[model samples]
Target: MSRNWTERDIPSQRGRVAVITGANTGLGFDTAKALAERGATVVLAVRDAEKGKKAAAKLGANADVTVQELDLAALDSVRAAAADLRGTLPKIDLLINNAGVMYPPRQTTREGFELQFGTNHLGHFAFTGLLLDLLLPVEGSRVVTVASIAHRIRAAIHFDDLQWENSYDRVAAYGQAKLANLMFSYELQRRLAPRGTTAAVAAHPGVARTELMRNSPAVVRAVFPAVAPLFTQSSERGALPILRAATDPAALGGQYYGPDGLGGYRGRPQVVASSPQSYDVAVQRRLWTVSEELTGVKFPVG
Candidate 1:
């Protein structure tokens, strides 16, 4: 329940392994760095190979960090990265589904799925299932998927038109994806329970300074000039809930953590509640089925 996670809280991670997606920058980068500093061998899965390498190099604080190319929006890249990691490491203590795309000009993934839903939710869903085996044998392992307050922006998943092809609304699609993250987290906690108390927690960065906001219209970015200081928090601070969910003994399944401030905007991390619709079971199952099909991956790990 404690929100704070200093170095002492992580314990010695000598033999453990961690895989973090989109770790080339933003909260993912900070999370990877923090874990690696605690001795967890952290894999930086990123879309750009060059940026990934630079990210690992910048993490001079953590010697165990490595860069691997992973394009979350591209199903092929996701599968290849998982296969490559499986080839190298047999077990992983933490799997942080951290990388995500946000409000971009209406786009589609390499597989043609809506960009936000594809990368932020479906991609991570498949990635975790493919890598589920890597964590089953590790004692007290976990997976943390990043969701957002934007979940409140929309109450439920649009099963009728999940791809937003029928009617594409950028903000709506983003909210749906973030909500999928929470639903997937809870559903995964159920799946991972038999794997020995492995947690499937969800966290949000509370409007941190990340490139996720990039590609937003100029007027959107302009808002950052005045109210920015109040609305935004640093990526390092935003990473606490994720690090805590991954390493904190007190963290449990189905919990939502985010900054504790105005509308859960900017402060320390704490257990929080997401929109009520996030707990819909049928929606969770539907999303999972769609994800497996989209990614051409299977669950039921060894």
Candidate 2:
């Protein structure tokens, strides 16, 4: 993130509209708070209505925030939410695909896609495409995708079995989903760069103390708790790169950012690079093709 930029520097967002998934807590909540505080009319798209409403209320009694029920794992929910948002929001300045599940004891989404991959990758993929119409015409419109360094552990996209039914390993499956997120961000950027309809950028919150890992098994959480204090950063700080990517004039499409120090676990946000696997054009293309087929959503053909 630009060193000089902060909530104090966020310019007026008076009439802007933003939609953030999983805005009930963690990175998503903090991100929503920052934007809403800047005067943006933020829609906290969440799976649970009560939690979303409570979180939005916490932002401020009169904060320009609304709670919308959106379950990413359910395409029907996503479609309905998109339609609702398009009607309510004339334009979308930012779509933060921040909601996701991680490291759960092998489960499946309502659609039967592996829970992690389904929620983290395909969910956002379809959501963005469906919401693109609202986003494309807005000046300075952007779609900020949150990926993770764990993407490096993904062994390719697993073309033959994306659902991972044959060999379902939780961590690898999660990594594959994250990798798909990066590829989608870059590919979307490439496709939209020429016309400048919008930009797609990716950012990772380096090992923040957020609830991203709360779904993990108790044993795993305890093991990591040993060194958690030494490294984990706050969720608000972790949202820096995403806030920067969404609003910073200098942020470019397809660029990825992360923490700048200590193995990228925590520090000021800066432009960062992913592992070589994330740069594979073929894998990215294949992932996009498969995602389109699986989600039954197509990008705008402008």
Candidate 3:
């Protein structure tokens, strides 16, 4: 019902502290750039410190930007990053879970969990839980997770074989992970509601042309070059939804944002609905429990 939202709509983030993962490139980088431009103290939590520093440099010396090493694929790295952040930052305004893998060959993470689920869902679950104390004390602080449109296609939590050990389907696995992201956001919102300090939100880029596609299927990659202009939006445009979710004062907990075009492929960012399945509360709780058990991380809320 509201007019189309753009980065220009983002309120000034002066004095706010935002930490975004995978900020070296693509949607994450764009999100960071927009926030920095608006005067937010931005921290690029990336796997490669050098790349993050390079990315921060592009934001210019005026932008208060820093880099922290984080590798979502490894739980140890996630723990170390969280501990380091807790020690440095007294409070956090935004925690954007933006880094993720997509459609990579069937592989396992350092902890032997499926790569997609481990890095995309469980890793974030642990990281957010570990850093939630800082966010819980900061009013208006938010935990925004970047989900995907793939969540509606071929996605279902395979509880029995969550690791994809029995079989592997790249698309399905990716869908499952994204779906988990959405569910996690929703569940987290419900948990954070009592205190009313921090909000949990989700957003999707909606077919943005970004480096995330480097691991996509060969067929998609081969044809992407030709169809990208026609079907996909630029990384900056794609990041609008995420930016809105992170900075929009009107945005509430449990909200999801994405493109407002045909099939949600492209256009301006707007509040959008995720797949019906993503709203399954029972499944969300189950996933949360399992995630804690697997990651050995517990949240202070709920």
- Candidate that scores best on lDDT: 3
TM-scores of the candidates in the order shown: 0.94, 0.96, 0.98
Ranking by lDDT: 3, 2, 1
Q: Local distance difference test, per candidate?
A: 0.83, 0.87, 0.95
Show pairs that collide, candidate 2. Answer: 1-269
True-structure lDDT of candidate 3: 0.95
Give one digit per residue, the lDDT tens place, for model 2 in 65-174: 99889988889998998889878887898999999998887888889999989999999999999999888887678999999878887546888888998987888888
Instruction: Please list the residue runs of candidate 1 whose C-alpha ends up more than 4 Å from where it truly belongs after superposition.
Output: 3-8
| Model 2 spans with C-alpha error above 4 angstroms | 1-5, 217-219
Candidate 1 C-alpha lDDT tens digits along 154-216: 546887888899877888889999998998898888777766746788998888888888866
Q: How does candidate 1 fare on TM-score?
A: 0.94
Error of 2 at 11 (Å): 2.9
Q: Across residues 98-164, which tens digit of lDDT does each residue of candidate 3 receive?
A: 9999999999999999999999999899999999999998999999999999999899999999999
What lDDT is reached at residue 202 by model 1? 91
